[model samples]
Target: MNENKFIQLLKKGDEKAFETLYNEYASKIYGLLRSYLKEDEIEDALQDVYVRIYRGIKGFKQRSKLSTWIYKITVNTAKNYLKKQKKNYLSLDFNLEKNKFTSKENVEKDVFDEIDYEFILNSIEKLPPLDKTIIKLRDIEGLSYYEISKIIDKPVGTVKSRLHYSRKKLQKIIEEDQNEGNG
Candidate 1:
């Protein structure tokens, strides 16, 4: 079924529609949450996101795409969970040793790759929650600035500025890593 029809069914409280929506979007939502939450926290956050989606579907005015609306709910729900727990949501424990390349040659080859995943993830973890969310939505999720503005309930200009600052901060972090490697 088309998205509009599905959404209409959802708004009407169709059980099958809910199931379909969950099946389609649950993994995407979970993946998005993984960037902002720890493994243990994601399931709880996912439940909360669905609850919000179900309850708020009636009020969804179609100002944005359904996917964007769902993403906004997921992001907000995860943020709320983190806030309640009073912990840094972006701090993920990455075991560098386990991820190490087996050979020195391989390590060197991978290190010089265009983007360093570890460095990028580490830098993202250090960002403030809002900046981190903005960067993730814009760069990682490939959301347009306008879509992001709607999700975060910020003006488009504010969204752009935050994304710009986040990118600059990430660039600085990458440059610092390079400098340290050279030194």
Candidate 2:
């Protein structure tokens, strides 16, 4: 079915369609929420995001893709959650965990990769919220600049520039970390 039709069904409170929508976007929304909320808060935030989507679906104007609209809601819901909780720290739960290794060499490589991934995730956490969000949306979520622009209510050029600067800053942070480890 077309997205529009599915959305229409969602608007009309069609249970099956809403279930489909939830199944489709749940993991993506959860990952996005993990970046903004603490682990303990994630399940609640995910529920809140879907609740907002369900209630707001009728008012959605279709100016953006449904996914973009959903993402915007998720971001706003997370901000609200943070505000309510009065928390200062943000976490990017980019769970790039590796589980299976074949040989000693592969095991060593996996360990190094896990360390590198952890270092990068830590570096990203140090970024300002906007930059962190842009990085998550583009690099982690694989969203286009336009979609990010819509979700964050910024210009496409701004999204592009921020993503560029964020990547460079992350690289510098990683390099500095490596130098310090070596030193």
Lowest lDDT block of 10, candidate 1: 96-105
Each prediction's TM-score versus the true structure: 0.75, 0.80
Cα lDDT tens digits for candidate 2, 1-183: 998898899999999998999888888888778778889999999999988998899999999899999999999999899999999667776643333211122323343354555666777777877888887777666678899999988999998778777666766776688789899
> Model 1 lDDT vs. the true structure?
0.75
Candidate 1 has what TM-score?
A: 0.75
Clashing pairs in 1: none
Give the lDDT of residue 119 in candidate 2: 67
* lDDT score, candidate 2, position 113: 50
